[model samples]
Target: MTELPDTRLFDTVLVANRGEIACRVIRTLRARGIRSVAVYSEADAGARHVREADQALCIGPAAAAESYLNIAAVIGAARASDAQAVHPGYGFLSENLEFAKALEAAGITFIGPNIEALNVMGDKIRSKNHVAAAGVPVVPGISEPGLTDADLIAAAADIGYPLLIKPSAGGGGKGMHSVFAAEELPATLATARRVAAASFGDDTLFLERLVANPRHIEVQILGDTFGNVIHLGERECSLQRRHQKVIEEAPSPLLSGLDDGGAVRARIGAAACAAAASVNYTGAGTVEFLVSDDTPDEFFFMEMNTRLQVEHPVTEMVARVRGKSLDLVEWQLRIAAGEKIDFTQQDVTLEGHAVEARVYAESPAEGFLPATGTVVVLEESVAQRPGVRVDSSLARRLKITANYDPMLAKVIAWGTDRREALDRLDAALADYVVLGVPTNVEYLRLLVADPDVQAGRLDTNMIERKLPDMAFRTVDAGDYAAAALAARKVDVARPNAPGEAPAASSWGRLDGWRLGDPAPWRSAWAAPGRTGVVTVSGPQADSGTEGPGVVHVNGIGGDQESRTALDLNGTTGGELLWDGQERGYRVGMLGETVFLGSGGWSVALERLDREAATARMLAGLEREDAAADPQLRSPMPGTVTVVNAKTGDRVAAGDVLLAVEAMKMEHQITATMAGTVHIGVAVGALVKADQVVATVEPDEDNSTTIPEGE
Candidate 1:
């Protein structure tokens, strides 16, 4: 064990990122009594991270290019606040070699591995070359620098069919594509290049043989300036979507076999430590690998993330630092300050099983499409036991925009065994509630509860394979009643608030009530964007028992009516109770949007007029005017910065109609059906969610559907 330094690493630190990871680092800084500074973009003017920090500065607008990625602005903010160190929390500038160089030149500590390791390991291709030369087993691929499209295609042919194209400059599945056939290469290559350039400013790419159904295993390591390094075991991160991990567990379940006792785990850990030592790496970093299913003993070096991983909690939960409450961020801070790690590899030990589930704001059922909306209600369950931890940046009134990754919260659970840890994780997932936008919580619930996941019969493609069987859990009539009742309760509670269009007296009055008489007023209430009204009936606010009572919700999409009876009379203080069910609920409402939540599962309902919901449903079914071209709308709010398709441009389904920039990420509005396009917006036009940006003529036979330039 090396000795400690007398001087503190940094008295004040500036976090050069936003969202949950920023807040996550701030937690340790606060615990250590270190003053923290935060930088935010215009979109995150009121972000939770901004409020949590001791001080904050605005860098640029919503786009990350002008803000979080704007190295100069971040440095200026840090200097202005007199911060001694900068923590790039897991994204944005976390892995940028230039950022580290800039911070070093500016005489401010960069709380990560030094610039040398970042340069060598940050570039995927270069890292592979370096590690393989150091005797690490790497995946078979073509990684020649400056390869042309033809050269890449020829290399792909040599690598055989079912190759993967990945951006050399970035990870997190961005700009990564799987080419299963020769025909898919051209388009896949084009899209990959575009995404790579947009995401990392460098479109340098590499090709690799696609390891089918391989389990993703990554080892966490901590190193210090004194050449001492330690491994914190491995995390099973096989479950992924589009190459990004969704769920992660420590002490990899996949590595457990009947006869092999810890040999494979030891080999992988030593390989990881060797990989780190080869780079002379310091601070917290993750070395990732892809182990083939058939040959469980063999593992190939995938890539090394030279920053704290998003799933670090799973490793932290399992591996406890003796005699310290320190986490990875703290270790990074100490290591950056030239402090030696007090413990060696022999001091570290994996205690028990732990699991982490990433609860994203995106909908898994809808092609895992990114959805953005205001968080109307955010409720987190307190983990009384040591097993549960939720790392999140969500707060009520927080707006989840499309300009960034759609991850909302992470639910982590630790237990004495795998089954107990899984049970705790499932309970935590059920208790995590988020509303006002679609989420993958329910899907995640079904996923963990699946037998294959429990048995650890998993791979990268398991989620995709099980998705068809895991269509979103059916919403019961009682669920509908609860959501509707909650939404209506909000509407009835607020009468004088602005932006609320007053409803007509006929629809507003309680059924069975006239002037000065007690009557049960019945009015039709509709679920937003659906067909039938629940026909909710309750007393007026001024009446004795002024609240929603019995709701006679009609059956959904069938002849059967009155699906469930709900006694929503006293569903207040954020709770709802149905007549038949025994499960108690907590409810929250924002304007007409209500989030009914309980046990970590939540659903959002919009209070809609019976006529409006019916009208919307009819419009979808009856594209009656075949001649009238359908309009393309922005599904999420953002500024229209690019319109690719012009009028009369023929396009197939999924063609980019336009690109909207929100929360620093570009959400391309693509065509749902094949058609000729008539773009409505120009570059630099700010657009709202669902605002019409273009129109498409679906009738292939009709060329004259769109007027010329008018």
Candidate 2:
């Protein structure tokens, strides 16, 4: 064990991260009255963390390698800001042992486990061996560093056919593969090796017996310099996609077991505490376990996270119920300064259930591929119910980039019981809004509403088996209607600068005006799956209004008797009335064109510019034609896998140009127009869908005779 420093160290700390985690740490630092500094990349200059911190500095470019992950730059920022410590918020350098050592060398506090602890746990195989030696029941597997093909096959037989081939030094589900049968062993092992090499620079492999439909339960463990350690209960993290957790809830239903009196719960919690004690772990850490519901009496160790988890909010909620703030960030800072745990393990108590859903900017239908774009719209409803909370780091104009994890925000809801907590979560998800880039909001809705999920019968494969349809349902018509209507309203009321046209009259005038004729009125329209349209009609009244006159849509048909004092007012300003209900509509006129708003869709009532409209119409038609023609284009957006043709090579219509892979699925691009090959894009070049990969120059002068189909 390492020696502890004196208490009350570090005046100011710099957070070397972006987005919600940065904001989260800053909030805690302020509560402790510690001066906090925030560092940002070029892309995150105007981010929420930059605004929230007491001081902010620009580190480097947007790419993580140069900005967030650049140890020198981060250390330089810390020195420049006179910061006494650096807090790595989760990703980037959070788990980097070298970064921790660098901070120590600089005489700065690293607010996490010491470098030795990180080095040990950083390697999965090594960590597993240590924990197994400490009496924790790890999954049945080989702990060898490297594995040959023969070794893998032999290990698979020992662990049984359905085994997990995982990188010995990997996390977040990357560099991991599950093999169901013996025939798939070679290919799965190869893929796992490649991913491991690319991601962690460690192609070392380990085989573990696959736990079928296992619940991912992790115990929150915190230790201090004095050897005091405790488990803050367990979190159920079974809802996942692409091996990344989507939803997390604390006080797992599995912990309750089928029997009462907390007998099994106590046993599991004791084991978790023992696991942490074995590591001599200090500060905030988590011990993950893969629990099989079929074998309720037994559970095996999965891994140990040496830092604060991404889903730490659930633990925070549990801590709040005990009338004490967990304050993980503050604790880490103090621990780095050598503060011991003052309270005993009995002080910690697991309270109400809290659930968190990670909102990511990605296309769920496209294998959850990360998406990057400006957030055009973002809204989350305020929590009106008690015991509910929300955590987010997005605004209306926040930009999501591809340099880091795709997670945009995390929505956490808490309640006195599991059912109420779930209800609050469902409501919050419904009210949550994010536009521009595709999100998994609707997919989350499906998961929350799932019967298995509600009944707490969740597992790692819950999403894969339960919601196969979710991968294809990209367009939610209701969401489209809401976005469209909101956009239209914004456009109509927008102010014009000098020399711009004035606002038009709210209502239109009709030609017929008689003593027995009906009065005019306006009507607001709304359709869930379609565009909204507004209609106006009534007797003509020649009152001088700024723009158009009001016409009653209800009185379009001539009724002999007057009903409900219906009267037409051509000069009436403000908003228009549709059958007594007021609909907010703004009409404007520019030159001879009159603009009318019907939700997001609008209509311009003026003589159309024949030439300009024709040009636009033709352009649209040509674009559509190009999109529909697949004969001379790339199949999908990806890097070119191979180049099969040369500039002067003669190629047939069915010849292959190159292959592309998107989200790990391969697609082949083929030649459709037969002629001399003119290769444009080369191998290893990036291309988008429908982009011209290669062009075939048609042979002239009967050099190439037309085929029968041609």
Candidate 3:
């Protein structure tokens, strides 16, 4: 472990954030023997960070504007807790200049870069210009203050086709749009402006020439108040969806695989340091760059993140200073407390390989929609496994809301080589389990196992191109069998049935027993768009035996049939012999639904009786006989941000009627068929997942399709 700085650190520090980042900062504070205070919104009263801190308090309501992002509220909490410093753990107010000034006025130290650095690097447009003037290569673009839509459109001709519009404020892929043609510029620019205005309260926009096949690479840099700065290698963040990074790794494969003996790495590291030194930067910061895949040696400056990045763990795992692991958080705190560099840039070394995968609360099968649920069963035992580490904010019974970002945790792994590190990371992901809430763990596993990803052929748009061809796993016979066994176990462990004898009588036990061949015990399981019946015989589930039992599965997606003698055991977890292998699986039952988890994939099977099954089948048939349901339900829970069509408006198929914004994603609800639309929800209305937001009365006269943005 790296030793703590000799200088005196702050007695108490307030974490002006929530979720896994807050918990991570608190961990470092505890290690340094400093008091940590955590602030949370009302919706996060029972959050993991709140429970982990030495002292905790409610900042405000669940809305970020009224709570986490409210500078006054965070300062007030810090004052009340007697905190000498505040750590805005990336996102909320981490790089907000006003927040930093307010902290200075309140006599509290801001554990981040200096005001000059924040002002220069916090805005993308300004940072690009500033870095270019500082002798750093930057992407060709038009970046001016207060550029209107008309101005941007006019400049597109000069910038050429295929351009990128980026918001002046905010990072993490928010408020960025790619326009491939002149006609697409107007609408895409409008969206970029709206997102920028709402997310960062700034509508200033700029355009950049879209680089083809670009690989995102960022270098981690740390500085001290004494004007010393050093860089800790780079991270590869090429795998992304919708501009948000999904996987990140240190010592980028592009540079590491080169035959030139670390010359390119040195050049990139020098550029990152130069960017930091331009503004006398202090604390930990990241300088991101766009490197073309075809021209690996050439790179251009993207933007600098003025706060600690979410992918900092990958750097920390592989970066070493003076032959010891480095902790970026500790350095940030120490620098804020007036400490000088104990080691020079030459002391930093990249040892081994480290990879990190972000675990998001989303449903990949549902177009990667943000999902919510109370965490019923969370298995993080993999964190204790060798070469693995998990940074998470998950707790059993903790509710996941769509009010914030969908990222719930990050699982990181390290090994002696890149392949070994990747294997370890994949294994760690497979061992992860979260019941009740849907996640992208399985998708991440598949991505890791992809041929191109394994061979290090990556680009920012690779996920979008590969998603359609990726074969995601679905519920199979093994999953159905596991659910049925769990349900049967619950039944056999219960009291006697209505017509059966009391528990004291041996005959009361419903263990599928009979005179000769045992009577088969059957259970009906239903999922969305599919139903199945699993029958088990030749064994007593309550006998505590881990042996053979005959099982037959029928009618899941079709009239399919399967019969096998399975060896399944345990209540919460067990080893199941399926498809010629005995694989471990986890089981959790909530209400009437049984959840089976294996290899980082989980499926929920709702239990149904004969009557319910028959009724469902009839209802499905009735729906098939009638025209499509005109009602457009919200795919995910969120606040309605825009209602494009008012009530009684004649809309055609593919017309966007409304939009729901959740987890930083805006899902537009469109008309599936031409009809007269009746809007059900207005702007700013909170909606639940699957709640009808609008209804359309089919109109044969309105058969024409509406143009986009009409």
lDDT of 2 by residue, 1-710 (tens): 12224544578999988888998999878877789999999988878889899999998997677999899999999999999988888878988988999999999888888676798788888888888887888899887776786798877887796888888875889867888999999888877786677567789988999897788888887788788887777888988866789999988877764575267666777788887787677888888889887876678988888888999998888664245657667677777778877666677777788999888766555455445555654556544556666666777667666556667788888888888888888888766666545577766767887888889888898788876654333222222222222222333335555565454422322322335534332223222111222222232222212233333221113221111111212211124333445443323333333333322222223322446445545654765554122235654456665677788898765666666544333355665545777778786687775577776665453243322112
| Models sorted by lDDT, best on top | 3, 1, 2
Cα deviation of 463, candidate 1, in Å: 1.2
Candidate 3 Cα misplacement greater than 4 A, ranges: 495-502, 506-520, 537-550, 560-570, 577-583, 609-612, 623-627, 700-710
> Which pairs of residues collide in candidate 3?
none
Residue-level lDDT for 457 in candidate 3:
92
Candidate with top lDDT is: 3
Which model, 1 or 3, shows the larger lDDT? 3
Question: Global CA lDDT of candidate 3, please?
Answer: 0.87
For candidate 3, write residues 464-536 as lDDT tens digits.
9999988888887777877887777766677775887876665776675546766777788887567788877
lDDT of 2 at 59: 88
**What's the candidate order when arranged by decreasing TM-score?**
3, 1, 2
Provide the lDDT at 189 for model 1: 90
The superposed Cα distance between candidate 1 and the true structure at residue 431, in angstroms, equals: 1.4
List where candidate 2 sits over 4 angstroms from the true fold: 1-9, 320-325, 365-367, 381-385, 470-492, 496-710
TM-score per candidate, in order?
Answer: 0.89, 0.76, 0.94
